[model samples]
Target: MKFFTGFLLSMVFLALASCDSGDDAGVPDKGYRYFPLAVGHYQIYDIVEITYTLRDPDTARYELRVETPDSFLNADGDSTYVVYRSKRLPGEVAWTYLDTWSARRTPEELVVQEENIPYVKLRFPPYNGQVWNGNAYNTGERDDYQLDSLGQGQTRGAQHFDDCLTVLQHDNEDFIVFLDQRKEVYAADIGLVYKETTQLSYCTQPGCLAQQLVEQGVIYKQWLKEYGKAE
Candidate 1:
């Protein structure tokens, strides 16, 4: 009888120890993850890629961002694009964005649309051209890039692109850093002002498509409650 009681007590102690060990192992390994921009929810998009060339005539500085399918000239004169964004929060950067590590990777060649990625679409005031595989003027190209540092532990993702504002110049005549203007919105009826240095728009081609709908009095305007400012 004494031996049996001792055996039972030992088993009970072992079981309790195993339960504690399991709990310690199950405290989820905390870390960041990457999700496409579409999964992010914000009233207004942080960046915008438009289909026009913004020129500073006074400073003789001009920046051209090709944002439509018409911008790329293929062997058959075709174009495609999509938006690859850096983060989901309006102004905050995420840890899982493709940045320094991606830039170090091998170059990627442009290809046709495939399953897996989401594309931004525009309806009203529609473009008189083909659909894009991703965002902006020229079709996707194989190149090298890094995420420009966003402040306070936020980092922009790296990308393959034609050009990004990698260098900062002191003179306003020398640079145009397209920035996200709104960190938060105060009121619905109030108007705002945006200086020349800062601008707000969607980041990728697909995001631009959504914005295009907003510009054209489409579904986005009725749904997303974000707005613009005075510049």
Candidate 2:
């Protein structure tokens, strides 16, 4: 599933690259953004984490309800959503459904757009003079550079914009995600500006989150702890 999605996007991105009209970062947020209102019952309110119950906007209940998964690339690449329920209670359910109006965007769309992409790549801030490409990010390569700063790499970030970095991470099974990260350059060593980390959380099970069977019928999630540095 993931490979198909990426493959389709790569072709689309390749074609779109021909008409690169510079940056279109602050366009989406320019229009009216939607916020979930508690329908008519604006009087009552109880904020819970997205991973929690799906509340009902009308009845103000939170019981026996269907829920929509609100995932995002914040630390992990997933879905994002707005809870909708005409009524609520402990047992009320949230009626979750598929949302259309999809997008074919690069990671740079986070700041340019208005999505909540966490800025975790800023561990290494820029030092002296240079242009910081806050999109050319890498994985686990935090030590050699500077702690949190956009650490320097062997490659030049001159062309690492939008989702261009994905070209470097293409078809790799070990790589689960790639987010547009903020970057800057020091005297010689480059520093990080900010990165909207696209975290991929999954379980190693037959039908678990992003599970796949590498051998036989046994399914598994390709994951590893980020405790070491990137070689």
Candidate 3:
């Protein structure tokens, strides 16, 4: 059985390259510009997260706003952007700070470190079907990241984006056996648009495994609401 959960964009003209990974550090390619990692750039989103436990399932709807307000140097001496994230529930005018995320845009890759898990969010020169190991830092697991689409238009809610790209990330079979399945989607310039993860395990008898497998599963969906550039 499956439980249904109900869910929840923007424009700024910044001349950036689309599709085409340029040469190495010495090469002057604008391919990495698709993401536009600047101090004054920010995005707001409406998020819906549903969790299904063995006993009951619940849903949470909130508004998430992330902003690139500050920057600092990391241990490697690379300057990184400080992404401040805040959350607001429905019918509330105040936003509370949730956490802080870090993004480092190198010539080769755009690295995002969230919750202490570092992810190579994007490789230079965006192209269709380009695959990379996003979970290279984690020794216990490997996640496959691929550029599913590029140079196409995408629309969500009342906002529309041109020259957009979508990247897909998936877990390996070993991880899937325990997690069921996990998938993530990221849009060019806009960042993450949608994400869905399902976890289901089966056992012949109760208490047969360390953790009991339930008939219910959790699902989460996030969509872009509105976005703007900082002054």
Candidate 2 per-residue lDDT, tens place, 73-154, comes to 4444533333222334454454333222211123322121113322222211222232233333323333222223222332
Q: How high is each candidate's TM-score? A: 0.20, 0.16, 0.73
Worst 10 residues of 1 by lDDT: 99-108
- In the range 186-208, model 1's lDDT, one tens digit per residue, is 11121111111223232235544
Global lDDT of each model? 0.25, 0.26, 0.71
Ranking by lDDT: 3, 2, 1
Q: State, as a TM-score between 0 and 1, how close model 3 is to the true structure.
A: 0.73
Q: Over the full model, what C-alpha lDDT does candidate 3 score relative to the true structure?
A: 0.71
Question: Which parts of model 1 have CA positions greater than 4 angstroms off?
Answer: 1-30, 33-44, 48-231
RMSD of each: 19.2, 22.7, 16.0
| Per-residue alpha-carbon lDDT of candidate 3 for residues 1-231, written as tens digits (9 for 90 to 100) | 122222100111222232333545346654665667778778878887777766777889999998999897779777799999999999999989999998998767888888888888789877789998888765537777888887777776666767666766764443322455555555556666555666655343545543445545666666777666889
Residue 125 of model 2 has an lDDT of: 23
Indicate which candidate wins on lDDT.
Answer: 3
- Which candidate order results from sorting by TM-score in descending order? 3, 1, 2
